[model samples]
Target: MGLFGPSEQEIETAVNAALDKRASIENPSVPLSSQNVLSFLGLDATSSAGERVTIESALGVPAIWAAVNFLSGTLASLPLHLYKRGKSGRERDTSALGVILHDAANDETSSFAWRKYIFDQVFTGGRGVTFIERSAGKKVINLWPLNPDCLTIKRIDGRKVYQYKDGKRTVTYEASEVIDIPFMLKRDMLSHYSPILSNREAIGLAQAVTKYGAKFFEGGGVPPFAIEGPFQSPGGMQRAADDMDTAVRKASKEKRLALSLPAGHKIHQLGVDPEKSQLVELQRFIIEQVARIYSLPPIFLQDLTRGTYSNTEQQDLHLVKHTLRRWLTQFEQELNLKLFGRASARQYVEANVDGLLRGDFKTRMEGYARAIQTAQMTPDEARDMENRPAKGGEADMLHIQGATVPLGSQPIRGIGDNGGPPLNDEGNNSNAA
Candidate 1:
């Protein structure tokens, strides 16, 4: 049958087969690579069960169900461990360290110095498209992304206006109000480079606005720069290019090594960890394979990257590959221990463990299915009526009396003569009921 969806048992059996293969190959002296583990199960490394049309998930949908079941199961086990630790008069500890570095060569600083450093130097700031508008008060104005072609300026008060610029940025100011001049650049220019700018550098290029500030305010002037940095630089534009070069060099060196090395070492040497690489490579392989089958990334990576600045599509893929590789490594280690007679008692420990240890995916899936089926059925008497129907022509009609009807029941009508019930002929309307 097509592998789009497989029965729970079928999924279980396939997973069991993969586990058996893992036991066999790992049981011997030979170590297993991530690639080897995939090959043994005839699995494409990149795809999830959801994507692949062929090659069923050996672990099955129930297994996936079990994985989710264990999600809370695993988390629930944590409190007890913490409690045990608390009894021992010990507690988990965490720490954070930070250092501020000044760009002495820039010769400028400001109150929000740190912001400049982070956005420009660290993030490699570049130009971006933003909208600018005057508030309803007319005294206040805002700068945001500007539409590239239409140049539509949407005010905070929900009014939209079209603005025209003749290759020049226009920063309008009220007669009494003061505002900072905006630096505008083409949208395409921002996309051409990274999106970080250093405050110190921008400050160095900034000119003092003494006349305007002195005229409007009692203060002498706003400083030449109000931001501090390691400023934006043309040199930093090559950051991505430099990163690519380093990656290429690393790859070339790793490829020159022998393939028989331990998988962990191989991955590490390539500047990646066995437990946390992206699945892009694996996915590519799977696409080349049977052109189907998909898998989720590991739990830890998903947890780490969820809803954060560090989270990205690339990061997600990295975590998936990393976790899968790590699992494969662990499997290989277990097998080696078995072969060497080092872990005789612990052999098959993973498989032997109950749902509490392995995962509770199956229980949850069945529970969910039951819940869904129940939800689809009508409640109370409606459900009962659907299960039972009276005899005769009326039985075909699902609706009875004034109520609507029930599931699985057909509709019917009673008529006289030809296609109707036998009509009474004793002075009763023969053709009418």
Candidate 2:
């Protein structure tokens, strides 16, 4: 310790040390040395999830892409609707909410774009974030999807808040103002589960396999000649041998399979084909594993190794029932919570999965026929689903083809009979007559 404050150098060092400590305490940083492992994903040392899975690793790997793409693409293609339930318990399309949610930004982004963004975020990071621009009454007016990685969640004074770091300054948003849809990552109500972080091993193996493949192909093939018997090589001799190897490679690339080797070297084939290495099987097995992790059908990820003619329809059903259904349900519940306040539960959001469940032409027609016959759906309803215009009077009407009559009475045979008499063939007869 120095009297009358420390020396200039000491003061500078102390201040610098203090600042470094304070900076670390204020804003934690991901270290640079922990940046890359496979030249793709980085396992950060300062992550709350205890592991940082890089986007490059997730997107760089094929299996991961197959799963993520299928999810994002499917969600974007589906039609989502907003419905309002009145006091009478009747629900109808709530267009006002629908307009905003469909586009979210109400500008350049499409409804599919909004859904795709949300779907991708949810599946990959297990958290989908959006900033809700609210009216004076706190009703949501505009919505913008925020980068989940940049968001920091907090709970203050029994109220949850989000601190959005943009550039230098931080912006705090109330829980109500931010749509924080988090999947159950670790029972922490705020932070979410990251699929990439959890499935690092599988993804890493995939990366390794992909790299091995690339490396193998990049080398063209194994060296065609192996040095046999006693041989000695000084610097000049080694250089010549390397030149010979380069020449052999050049020849192999030019489709000249025949190679002239030096006297001491004979052509020794080292054959380990992809089939023998079980790479095809490994690729397929990895695909299935990824599918299971995402609760997706292997067929959905373009894995047709196990697909069959009869099981195709069943696979479609499985996709809707198991995979998309769960995701849609989560979306519905999350939208309900975020868009509609928890206090007053009048309106909720729903995705029209019926469109996804529609089978092929014949199957669809049969199902529609049954629905129409059972009075479960009107002719117009069925036709509307098929994108066809209404056919007129009977198309709008609901019919039950029981061929029975009114209570305590029988169905009249013709227009003349009023629950009394049957008409003679082509002739009108009635009790009223």
Candidate 3:
């Protein structure tokens, strides 16, 4: 009654009465579509637009319990993970990890942020907040809370307002029905945001791995910065190294290979136990797969698996696509944005030779081998080909001169001029010598 103008008990009575009335109207003994059943309760079609409301309502008690448990358990676990990831600094006053944990006791937004750290990547618009508004021709789902539970659908027409010929306009606004279900909410919210987050994460991870490979192993730079004295403390460094070696060997032997450069260099690599590496890789893989699901620009995956056990490539890609798609359906119908379009975009690009040049060197080599075989050229014949000469002579032979634009004037082009073409379309004739 405070905000809704009825006591909780009164609302419950009304809701129950509406449900009974609806059941009788439809068919008391038959199973009905949840929407049809909900409609009998006076929660009509307009309220159910862009939503799967009835299912949540049917599972109301379970949904609430699930939310409560999530809020209590998973939400509580993030700080520990963050701390382990070094969100808190090393060398704190105590060895106890929980001492530095950040707690958001009373803040819902902060709690939401923690939820985002977990599920937002897998959902639409990072936990969708939307509302339905009717214009003349279509429904406008206005952006609202990033996470919305109570949405009011309003209907109005241009006729309700003055046509520049009437005085005061009559507007019809109502809270038609409630869409307070968890799964539908989760679905709608996850769809728009998950693909974006997943795809972005995947692409970013790929880029990072690509860069890591290029910078450290391929380019001969220092390996990642490690904790300084952990290796020197009595038997500590040796144990860590041995553990890393053991982990690598097991991964190699079990065919559980993770990302690595040639000659046993790791990309986004950590030399820890297989379990720890898996955890780290899982974190990285999840991030990358989500990014790829969202359609980020082309990210090159270097064959860091280079001559080892089973390829982690397929496993990694499979997880990414599966997770991304699971969350993609949630926001797609509501937002109408296709998050899985990037693979198609990539396929379109691969139809040309440009794809080969931009592809991994192994692909290029295979292509070259295929070309050589198809041409039936002997190694000696292929080796005898000469480099083609350029049609235009070298610039050094032409005595070409270059210049810069004056401070206040636009640049000009053509013989003797340093600047680009003059402003006039008359072909640089406007410039005074």
Candidate 4:
């Protein structure tokens, strides 16, 4: 031991001992692993609704599929651009890194595909991870996605590291080398809460309702019924019941409107119909639940039960403001941090959500006109946003409405004929006064 402090060997031993102690405390017997093999296999504990709500099962629900697919596709379709901060202002970075973000992450995968895949994992598996492959000079070469199921995250020496199991070999990556986005993080910070797992009851109920409806319809929309007959022996009663079932099925198959039954046998409907069970209403409610889980408005999930012209428009705004903005910001920050590092003050990534308004021609035109008249953006800039070629010259200069002058800076008199004098409201020269 040194006089000033503990020896380096002692510190190493202490750190190792602390890690071991933490492991033992966290998992006394077997080590608690984050491997998602069971989840990948669509195996999870049965939900309250008596349905297995694994990621796959939850996705089998139409509402969940719509929610996840809509969000992932919408985010992926947005244009991501890399920008560099300069003395003048921020300008779009047109370097290879920018291309990697805007166009393609690698030679084989497009930016859209990569982003969609990442968010798909986030929504379903609860975490999305991508590795930034860098060249020897620290230049980004390719962005590769890592399967969240096979990846485990740990904090080692006060730094987060990722361990990805690739077949028989395990590869380790530093936090800086990975872009990690979680649907929701747990208290441990290493693990995440899956949407399907957290809200399994709602999703499971949806699945159950769908399955029940399907089975009901598959039986030719026939409700379960009890056949009451005058039978003396139990064997005769069983045979009668089987004959009734077979007759009902044959009648359904032949599209017969009426069925001939045994004498003195009455068919009593035993279960409530789908309408009485409120299956449609229940399915709609489940859709709303899913929308809530993803922070989406019901309109986005194609639920028009309460949609109106004005409210639907408001929901569109809400989707962008409340839903897409959060995800876009999270993804952008993650990309900027992993690709450029925290110390990189000049360059960062951004997703241009203005593309969402592309279909709103009138809105886009009016917004561009307002921006131009307010001197907020030049004509060329607006054109560039629309992917149109710049007209250059005066079009590149910021323009404002000629009548938009300072409050107290109005001219004393308006120019008259030949620019000689001013005209008044009475069509006379104001100089006469």
lDDT of 3 at 109: 33
Q: Judged by lDDT, which candidate is best?
A: 4
Q: Comparing 2 and 3 by TM-score, which wins? A: 2
Give the clashing pairs for model 4.
Answer: none
Q: Write the per-residue lDDT of candidate 3 for residues 282-346, one digit (tens) a residue.
A: 54454335334333211222223232334454544443355333332333322222211333221
Q: What TM-score, over all chains together, does every model reach? A: 0.15, 0.79, 0.20, 0.84
TM-score of 4: 0.84
Model 2, CA-based lDDT: 0.69
User: What's the best-to-worst order under lDDT?
Assistant: 4, 2, 3, 1
lDDT of 1 by residue, 305-340 (tens): 234644554544553354334433343343233222
The alpha-carbon deviation from the true structure for residue 42 of candidate 3, after best TM-score superposition, in angstroms, is 30
Candidate 4 lDDT over residue span 1-433, tens digit each: 3343332234434545555655885656533332232333343446788887778988899889999999999999998999999999999999999999999999989999999999999989788899999999999999998898778777799988898878789999999999999998777667677888888888889989989999997777889988888999999999988887788788889898788886898989988999999988898899889988999999888899999999998889888998899998899888888887789899989899877755477888998988887888888899998899999877887776655442334445664477656677987887786
Q: How many backbone clashes does candidate 1 have?
A: 47
The residue-by-residue lDDT of candidate 2 on 329-429, one tens digit each, is: 87778778877778756677777778888877998999987777666778888998989998866676666555422222434477655655676565656
Q: Flag regions of model 1 displaced more than 4 Å.
A: 1-160, 165-271, 274-433
Candidate 1 Cα lDDT to native = 0.30
